[model samples]
Target chain A: MIDSIARPTAAIRARPVLGAASVVALFVALWMALIWSPPDAAMGNVVRILYVHVANAWLAYLAFVVVFLASIAYLWTKRPAFDAIAVASAEIGVLFTGLTLVLGSIWAKPTWGVWWSWEPRVVTTAVMFAMYVGYLLLRNLSNDLERRATRAAVLGIVLVVDVPIVHLSVTWMNALHQLPTVLRPDLSPTLDPRMLASLVAMTIAFTIVYAYLMTARVDIERRRQARIIEARA
Target chain B: MTIARIWRIAAREALAERGHPDGFVAAITFVATLILVESLAVGPLAAGQPPVAAALFWIAMAFAAILATTRSFDRELEDDAIDAILALPGGRDALYGGKVVALTALLALVALVGGLLSGVLLSLAIALPGHLALVLVAGVLGLPPVIVLFVTLALRLRARGALVPILALPVLVPQLVAATNGTAAAIVGDATGALGWTGLLIAFALVYSVLGLTIVPTALE
Candidate 1:
C-alpha cells in the first residue's frame, strides 16, 4: 500500500496539467475581475475586491470541507493518504482564510470606512481561522505519525461541525433583541451580470488553484511518510 | 451495565478530586482572577453593564473549564491511569462520560463562584435568578465534553498546556456567545430570550457529548 501510494504515476502526470490549467484560469479570472467587470454603482472600483475576496472565502470553506471529509475517511479507513489529504487541505485552508481576512479588510476600508467590524461574517471567519490554526498546531504536537493523524482527524471532525454553530451564534449575538429585518444591511449587494460572471470565473480559478496545491502538498506528505517507513526498516 | 460502569467511573473521578481538591481550587481562583482583571480593564462603568458583565462571566468560566479539565487528564496521565481505564470493556466511552460528568460538576462550582464574584465586582443584578441559574447549568453542561475530548487528545503531547486552549477555545466560541447572551437576557428578565440561548447551549452539549463518545476511542488510540 505504501509503495502504491508512493508511486502514484497517474497523479504525478496530472500535476503539470493541473498547474497549467490553474495558471490559465487565474489569468482569465484576473482579467475579468480587473477590467471586464463593471464597477459597482455605489462602491465603484472597491467592489473589484469582492471578486477575489469572495472566491478566497469560498475556497477556504471548500478546503475545510475537504479536511472534514478526508478526516472522516482517515478515521474510517485508517489510511495514511486520507490523513495526508486532511492536513494538506487544513494548511491551504488556513492560508486562504488568512487571505480572505486581508482582502476583506482591504475591501472594508474603502467601503465601510473601517478596516474591521464585529459583523457576524467577520467574527465567524476569524473564529474559523483560529480553529484551523489550532488544528495545525495540534498536528505538530505529536511525533508519531499514526497517533498524530488520528488525533487531528478527531479534531477536524469536531471543528467542521462547529462552523455553522459559530456562525449562528455570532449572527444572533448582534441581532438578539432586534428583529432580523431591522438588523444590519446585507453584505452582498445585488451584483451586475458582468460582475456575477467575474465572480463565477474567480471562484472557478480559485478552485483550480486549490486542486493544484492539494496535489502537490499530498505528494510531499506521502513521500515524507514513505521516508519515515524506510528509516524504520 | 454500561450505565452502571459509567456512573462508577464518574464516582471514582469525584472521589479522586475529593482526595486532592487542588485542581478545583486552582480553577476557581483562576476564574476569580480572570473576572477581576477583566473588570479592571473594562473599568467600573462598562463592566457593570449587563452585556459586558455577562461576557466577562462566561469568558472566565470557559478558561476555567480548560484549566480544570486539562488538570483532570494530567492527573490521569501522571500515573498511566488512562491505559488502565481503557483496558476495561467499553472503557473508552465510559471514560469519556466519566470525565465529562466530573468536569461538568467541577466547572459548575467554578461558574457559581465566578457568577457571585462577577455579580459583586461587576454589579450585575439578576432579575430572574432561576433563569440565570438554568442558563449557567446549560452552559456548563456543554463545556465538559469539549474540554474532556480536547484535553484527552492533547494529554500525551508536548506543550499541552498551550495546546489544549488553542485547540478548544475556538470551538468553544459558540458556547461562550450563547452563554454570555443568555446570561445577559436572564439578568434583564428576558425569560424568552434567555430560554432560547439556553436551548442552544443544551443542543451544543448534546451534540458534543455524542460526538465526543464516538471519537474518544479513536482519540485514545
Candidate 2:
C-alpha cells in the first residue's frame, strides 16, 4: 500500500506546465502593475505597492483556507496526501503572510508615517502571522508522521477559527480607543479601469504562483514521506 | 453520568492539587514575578496608571495560565496515566472537561491573589471591584480550554515546553486583548465598556470549549 501510494502521479508530471504558466502570468502582472496602471489621484505612484501587497495578502488568506480544508480532510481520511497538502499550504501561507507584513510595512511608512500601527487589519495580520508560524513550529515537534499530522491539523483548525475573533477584538479595541485618524489616509481609493485591471491581473498571477509552489511543495513532502517509509521497510 | 464523571475527574485533580500544590505555587510565583518585573520596567509613575496596570495584570495571567496548564499536563505524562484515563468510557471529553474545570478553578484563585496584589502594588484605585472581578473571571475562563487543548496535543512531543507557548499564546491574543481592555474599563469605572469586553471573553471561552471538545479525542489518539 505504501509503495503504491508513493508512486508519482499525473499531478507531478504536470508541474512544468504550472511553473511556466506562473512565470508568464507574473511577467504580465508586473507589466500591468508597473506601467499599464494609472497612478492614484491622491497618493500617486505609491499606490502601485497595493497591487503586490493586496495580492500577497489575498493569496496568504487563500493558502490558509486551503490549509483549513486540507487539515479537515487529513483528519477525516487519515491520508498522507491530505496531510502533505495541509503542510504545504501552511508553509506557503506563512511565506505569503510574511511578505504581506513586509510589504504592508513598506506601504505604511509612507502612508501612515509609521512602520507599524495597532489598526485592526495590521494587528490581526500580525497575530495571524504569529499563529501560523506557531503552526509550522508545531509540525516539527513530533517524530512520528501521523502524530505530527494530527497535531498540526488540530492546531490549524483552531488557528483558523481564532482569526475572526482576533480581528474582532482588535477592531473593538481600536474602536474604544479611537486612535488618531489623521495619519490614516483613505484606503478605499476610487479604482480606475486600468488600476482595477492591474489589481485583477496581479491577483490571478499570484494565484498561479501559489499553485506552482504548492505542486512543488507537495511533491517534496511526498518524497520525504516515501523516504521515511523506505527506511523503515 | 458524563457530568458526574467530569466532576469526579475534576475532584480527583483538586485532591491531587491539594496534596501537591507545586503547580499552583509556580503559577502564582510566575504571576507575581511578571507583574513586578513589568512594573519596574515601566517605571513607577506609568505603572500606577489604570490601563498600564490592567495590561500588566492580564499579561501576567496569560503566562501564569501557560505555566499552570503545562504543569497540569506534565503530571499526566509523568505518571503515564493518559492511556489509562482514555481507557475509561467517554474519558477523552470528560478528561478535557475535567481539566478545564480544575484549571479554571485553580486560575481563578491565582487571578484573585494576583489581582489584589496588582491593585495594591500598582496603586490602582478600582472604581468598581465587582466588575473587575467579573472581567478576571471571564478572562480566566477563556484561557484553560485553549491551553488544555494545545498542551494535550503537544503533551508527548519533543520540545513541548517551548512549543506549547508558541502554539497557545497566539490563540490567546484575542482573549488577552479583551481581558486587558475589560480590566482597564472596570478599573476606570466604565461599566458598559467592561461589560462589552467581558461579553467578548465569554464568547471566546464558549467557542474554544466547543472546539476543544470536538478535537481532543482525535488529539489524544
Candidate 3:
C-alpha cells in the first residue's frame, strides 16, 4: 500500500507542470473570446465577457460533480487518492464559483443597474460559494486527514443541492435578476455560430485541462501522503 | 438484526437524551430570544408594511431550528453513544435515519408549541396562521440535512460545538430560503407557487437519508 503511493510522488516530480500549458492555452482562448469577439447591441462588449463568466459557472458544476463522485469513491473504496481528488476538486470548484460571482457581479453592474440583488439565483450562488468556503474551513480546522476526508466527503455529496438550487433560483426568484435567456431557457444556442463554436470548444478545452490538473494533483498528493507515512515510520 | 429492532435501538438512543437539561433549556431560550428580538421590530414592521413579515418570521424558525438540530448529535457525542452506534455493523444508517426522524419529531413538537405562541404574540407583526402547517412540514423536511451534518461532525470532531453552526448555516441556506418562502406564501394566501419551495425541502431530506446511510459508516470509522 505504501510503496505504490510513494511511487506516484517521484512520477509527479519527473513530469511537473503537466497541466500548466493546457490551462494557459484555455485561459488565452477565453481571453480572445471575450476581447476580440464581436459585441451585441443589447449588452455590448460587456456581454461577451459572459463567455468566460458562464464557462466558469459551468466549470463550477463540473468541479462539484468530480468532488461528489470522488467523495463516494473515497467512502466506498477507502482510498486516499479519492479523498485527495475530492479535496482538490472542491478547492478548484470554490475558485470557479468565486470567479463566477465576481465576473457575474461585474456584468450585473453594467446591465442590471445595481451591484447586488436578492434574486434566488444570486442568493443561491452566494450560498454555493459560502458552502464550499465552509467546506474548506472545516477541513482546515480538523487535525486528522482521515477524519477531514470522511466529514468532507459526506458534506460534498450532501451539498449537491447548491448547484441545482442556483440554477432554479435564477428562473424563479424574479426579484431583480431575469431568467436565463441563452444557455438554459431557450436551449436553442442563440449566439452567433462563431461564438457558439468558441463556447463549445472552450468547454472541451477546459475539460481537458481539468483532466490534466486532476492527474497532476492526485499524483502530487500521493507523493506528499507517502512522504508523511515514511516520516512516521 | 430486524428492521424494527434496529429502529427501536435508534429511537431509544435518541429518546434516552431526555435528561439533558441544557438542550431543553437552550431550545426554548433560543426560540424565545428570537421572538423577543422580532417583536422589537413591530413598530417598523407596521410602519413600513414591508410586504414580507411572514418571511421574517420563518427566518426566526430557521435560526431557531439550528440550535435544536445541533443538540441531538451533541448530546449523543457527550454520552459516547456514537461510538457504540458505529460498532453495531450496518447499524449506523438505522441510527442515522431513526435519529433524524426522531429529532425532527422532537423539534416539530417544540416548534408547534413555541411557534404557535410566537405566532399569536407576534400577530400584530404578522398573521401567519396558514403558514403553520407548511412551516411544520418544511421544518420536518428541512432538518435531515442539518441533522446529518451535525451527526457527521459530532462523530468526527466529538468536542467541537462551535464549528457545527458555522459549517451548517451556509449549506442550510437553501433549505432556509425554501421554508421562509413557503411560509411567506402560506401566510399571504399565495400558496399557488409554494410547491417548488416545499419540494426543495423534501429533496433536502431525501438527499440526507440516502447519503447519510451510505457515507456515515466510513465517516464513523
Candidate 4:
C-alpha cells in the first residue's frame, strides 16, 4: 500500500515558472551561441554545433547519474517517489543520448569528414545507450510494480559498474590503434572566449531543462499513483 | 564448511550435467555448426592468420557459453528448485558460487572444443599450446558469472532466448577482446604478452564473480 505522501495539490503552479525559466535560458543560450560567439578560426561557423552537441551530451550523462542515484535511493528506501524519479530520469536520459549521437554525427560530418567513426568515445557512448535501453525493456517485461522496481534497480547497479570499465577498455583499445582523438586535444588553450561563454551558458540552460523535465515527469507519476490508490480504496 | 558445501553443490551440478547432458550436447552442436560456417566465411586461412581464426573461435565459444548458461539456469527455475534452495542457510552464496564453478567448467569445455575445431577446420596451428590454453582458461573464468546473472535476469521475461545475448554481450566486450587478443598472442608464441591479457581476463573474472555473489540474491528475490 502506498502511503499518502504530502504533495502540493497545486504543484502545477511551480512548473510554469520553471518552464519559463528554462525557455528563457534556452533562448539566451541559442542567441549567445549563434550571434555572440565568434566564428571559429579553424572551422568557421561550423564550430557552433558544439554549443548544442556538448550541452546535450552533458545532459545525457547527468540524466543517467540521476537514474543511478535514484535507483539506489529506491532500493534503499523502497519508496515509489524514488522509482518515479529513476524511470523519469531514464526516459530523459535516453532521449538526450539519442540527441547527442545525432548532433555528434552532424558535427562529425564537417570536422572528421565522415558522418560516423568508430572512435572510442563514440563506441562507448553507443554501447551505454543500448545498455540503458535494455534496462528500460527489462523494466517493461515485469507487470508488478515492486518487482519491476527491484529488478530494474539491480540492473541499474550492474550497468553503472560496467560504464567505467567500458570507458577504460575503449580508451586503451583506441590508444593501441593510435587513432586521432575525436575531441580536440588542445581544447582549453585553443577555445575562443565567446565560444566558451556560450558553451557554459548552454550547459546551464540544458541542465535547467533536464531538472524541470524530471520534476514534471515525477509529479505526473505521483498523481497517477495517487489516483490508483484512491480507486483501490 | 561453506567452501565445501559450495564445492558439493558444484559437483552436483556437474554430475547432473553428465546424467542429462542436454545443455552440453546443444552447446557442442551449436559450436560445431558455428565453426563450420565461420570457416566457410573466412576461407582457407593463410599462414600466420591466427588472429582471424582466434576471432572466429572466440565468437563461437561465446555463443555456446550463452546457450549453456540459458540451459543451466532455466533448469533451476524448473520444479521450483530455486525457491527451495534460496530458503537454505547461506543458499544464495552457495548457489552463486556453485553456478560460477559449473559455468566456468562448462564454458571452458566449449572454448577448448571451439579452439581445437578452429585450429583444425581453419588450418590454424597452435604454436604455443600451453599459452593458448592458459588464455582460454583465464577468459572462460570471466565469461560465466555475467552470463549466469543475465540468464537469471531474463528468466522472468517471455523472450528469454533473445534477451540473454542482448543484455550480456555488451558487458562481455572486454573479456571477448582480451580472449581473442590473448589467443592471437599465444599463437604467435608470445607467452609473456599473452600473460598480460590473461591477467586482464582474471581481473574481469574477479570483478564479475564478486558482483554476482553480492547481487544474485537480490536478483533471485
Tens-place lDDT per residue, model 2, B24-60, is 9999999999999999999968988888898898888
CA displacement after TM-score superposition, residue B173 of candidate 1 (Å) = 0.9
User: Count of backbone clashes for each model?
Assistant: 0, 0, 0, 0
lDDT of candidate 4 over A12-125, digit per residue (tens): 457777799899999999999999999988889998998898788778778888888888888788887888788888889889988988998998888888898887767777
Clashing pairs in 1: none
What do the candidate models score in CA lDDT, each in turn? 0.86, 0.86, 0.68, 0.80
TM-score of each: 0.93, 0.94, 0.85, 0.91
Q: Report clash pairs, candidate 3.
A: none
Q: Considering every candidate listed, which one attains the maximal DockQ?
A: 1
**Candidate 4 CAPRI assessment class:** medium
Candidate 4: tens digits of C-alpha lDDT, residues B41-103: 667654228787777777878888899878887787785777877788888778878888988
From the highest DockQ down, the ranking of the candidates is 1, 2, 4, 3
lDDT of 3 at B14: 55
Candidate 4 scores a C-alpha RMSD against the true structure in Å of 3.2
DockQ score of candidate 3? 0.54
Model 3 RMSD vs true structure: 3.5
Give the per-residue Cα lDDT of candidate 1 at A115: 91
Model 3 in CAPRI terms: which quality? medium
- Which of the numbered candidates is closest to the native, going by highest TM-score? 2
For candidate 2, the TM-score is 0.94
Instruction: Estimate, for each residue in A1-233, the C-alpha lDDT of model 2 and write its tens digit.
Output: 57755777787778899999999999999999999888878788998998998899788888998999998998999989989999999999999999999998998887778898777777778889999998888887677888889988888787787455433454455532233222224554446778878988999999999998998999889988888777778
TM-score of chain B of each: 0.97, 0.98, 0.80, 0.94
